[model samples]
Target: MEILRLDSFSFRYPHTQRCALKDITLSADEGDFVLLCGASGSGKSTLLENLKPELRRNGERTGEITCLGRPLQSLSRMESACDIGFVMQNLEAQLVADTVRGELCFGLESLGFPPEVIRRRVAEMASYFGLGKLLNRSVNTLSGGEKQLVSLASVLSLSPKLLLLDEPASQLDPVAARELFSMLARINSELGITILLAEHHTEELFTLCSKAVLLHNGQVSFCGAPREAARFITQNRTLSSDAIPPQTKESGSAYVFTSLLPSAAKIFPDEPSLPLSVREGRALFKQKISGRTPPAPMPVIPPTAPPAVSVTDVYFGYGSKDTLLFHDLSLTLYEGELSAVMGANGSGKSTLLKLLCGLLKPKRGTIELFGKRGAKPTLGYLPQNPRLLFLADTVQQDLTACAENLRLLHPEERIQSLSEALGISDILSSHPYDISAGELQRAALAKVLLSSPRLLLLDEPTKALDPFAKSKLAALLRGLVQSGVTVLFASHDTEFCASYCDRCALLFDGQTAATGAPAQFFGGNVFYSTAAARIAAGFSYDSVTCGEVRNLWIK
Candidate 1:
């Protein structure tokens, strides 16, 4: 039975001329795991929000929406709240309670559940999601992944029949993300709940989803089975090459939507059938590389430049009474290189960046910049939450203020260039909060780059960026590195680190566990590696990115 359907749905936000979603016709059956995908600002979030009446944006909407065999707009508040559950991309925004247990009980209590019933539900959720130790922990103290899990459990505690998720794994590490997806699969398969998820990370989800929907410029571009959708996108990209913008054509693929395809699908776009899993990709790779000699491994050259930022035996924590997050952690970042600091959630990656930027002083040991202890150098720091960087109402206002405050010459010219380069020129007039997460990330980055700092520090820089935007960011960072700026960023995106960063440092047990070039770092990793690296592992090539795999095949 069809649990939900949208017929000719079109919506436009207030004060906006263009529609956010246009003529969107879609449906989801009971127990169906539907994957919704597209580039940044492609109406994915807008559509998801509209589906949940309580969270829907104030917009000019025209359409027929049916839920559980009734018009969606006519559903009572109680029916809407208990039957449909929504999880937002920003975990902090959805969580309101102080503790994990409180969060799980918030919804049930609001709905007038008895204390005994709430206790049983909360207990079940805690045990099922392994929240036993964290039940009483403060939500603010939890890591990003932990917060995400808590948010999901809180929503599930209400026992909704349908779940709407927006980039649920955007903030999680690879292993955590896989586990979250596995749990979501179980929720759909075993419990018979319907799930509609909007995400850019489709590698693991494509094979699990029963159906796929692709949106472009506020319209439904493709809707079909996951495999057929991949084939359609590949064919469309080839046939419409001339229609692609000149700027994006050089990126190899025309449409940013194609970047949402699985790595194997991207590597073999012309194949009769695209591979969606590592097992399938390895088989295809073996068949293609049969009787071919493997290429020599790339040489690893250590940087000779002086240390831009050095941390020696640093110890830090939130308070004197709190447990130390970093215990004698030491690391070095050389000048004129882009380095990535990666570790599991709550492993002090963000805390380390704060110490380098002087936002938080180390409790023990020392941090030095350019050989000087406590010397405040010109630096740029982008925190994990990009929303914190915006002070002005509009994006343009924020960026202009940043430039003027820095006393930069030709402020308008610099702003124009950066905005255009970041692909946020169109949203300059809009409020920073009004843009999509990916767009907001670029806007924050624009503000940081306007300063022209000698050293750059970023935490989770690629948190919400699409693949095309990621490529652009990689190129932009490469240009900055060539011009003598040093960069150190902490991230959970192993794929981006493997593909673009100069070095990969893994933090474990409150210290640098291993640090090396991408080939040597991710090449040795099993669960922490990229799909391309795992697929090419059979040939012993140590290729860690799709581009490397493609180049190897061409040679």
Candidate 2:
């Protein structure tokens, strides 16, 4: 059934000159999984917000929005509950309770649902969403992916028929992302729930969303099949931010995404589509080349030292896991080296980072950064949930809020430069809560950079960023590494691991499966290897970074 419809919708924010939604019309039937794909600042979220009036503030609208033949404005707040369930990008913004069980019952309780009914629905939703284990855990203890699931389950606890997910999987790990989407698919299939998801990645969504809609600037530009959208995006490389629908697709190792990329990137694997960022994708492609192993080029480093970081017998994990994160996991990161740690979700990759940053006391292991221990390591750790550490109000304040002893030297210079590079410069004065998730992350990164630490620890650094931001971040990390700094990041994007990092360490089931050259290591793991990497004969030493592969080709 066609559950929702928009007719000539046009909207503009009070102070803005440009219309956030321009004469837009769209429709989705129950059981249809529709995706709104686009870049950051695109109208995907704006359009999604239109479904709920609470999401808007003193906005002007000239068109009609109808849900089940009734005007959107006329539907009672409680009626919309059983109809459309909207999930915003920022989970915390929507979360209301301290504990997981409390959060699940919030919406149901608001409606005065019977206690027994709430209990039944909550338990069912928790088990169905794989959140039963987290029912008693504090909301603060959950990871990004876990929180997203909790939010989804909480929404489901209300028994809504239509699900509106905004950038839903942007913060999830690969395995969890896949599972979450799969669950959504089943809900649509069995329960007849109509799903409309707005996201940056589109490749995976292509197969899931029966119909695709691309909003450009604020207008409906491409509304058609996934394959057709993919062709349109691939052919038009010069789409303006306002003229093209945001699209991202998984092509190979890297996500080939842009306003021009297909919609699969955001859908599958929770990876972004490369908007012409093929450093890692190309590197993986080159690795498959067989005939003769190409000779390696002269080393980029000028006869530099061997390495900077060394970890031996690293063992760490949560209670009752019955295994170390990495038993006998040994690896070293050379100075001026950029390495990516790749693996499926829950691979203890984050734990490995904790050991390196001294966030966790290793159970039975030793870690040496710059050949030292028991000292404040020069490592800058970017935790998965950065917003928790934020105490200041304004973006500028957070970046420069520290006192003399802890203050960054010349923070203004670094903040302005890094902010512009990461595309968060315009919102420097805005409150942290007012900005986009992508913008906040960039701002946090700028703050981290201000400290000028020698080693950077990034846990899923690319979670909510768009292609442009991702490219800038990659370049910035590269620049840092070239300037004698080192980076060790955990990520699910195989293309990123291949293109930027000098090496890759694979983690699985709370242990390091392999640590070596990305190109070589990726070749053996189906979950880690890129499409091009698999197609290419094989990699030389699991080398996944583009510079390495390009030099290897040249030689």
Off by over 4 Å in 1: 238-254
Compute the lDDT of residue 492 as modeled in candidate 1: 88
lDDT of 2 by residue, 219-294 (tens): 7877786656655555544333222323333332112234225222211112243322233344434443445654
Q: How does model 1 fare in lDDT?
A: 0.87
Query: Over all chains combined, what TM-score does candidate 1 have?
Result: 0.95
Model 1, residue 269: C-alpha shift (Å): 2.2
RMSD of each: 2.7, 6.8
Pairs of residues clashing in candidate 1: none
lDDT of 1 at 59: 78
Per-residue lDDT of model 1, residues 26-118, tens digit only: 999999999988778889999988989998888799989999889999999999998899999998899999998889999999999999999
Query: What TM-scores do the predictions have?
Result: 0.95, 0.78
**Model 2, residue 400: C-alpha shift (Å):** 4.9
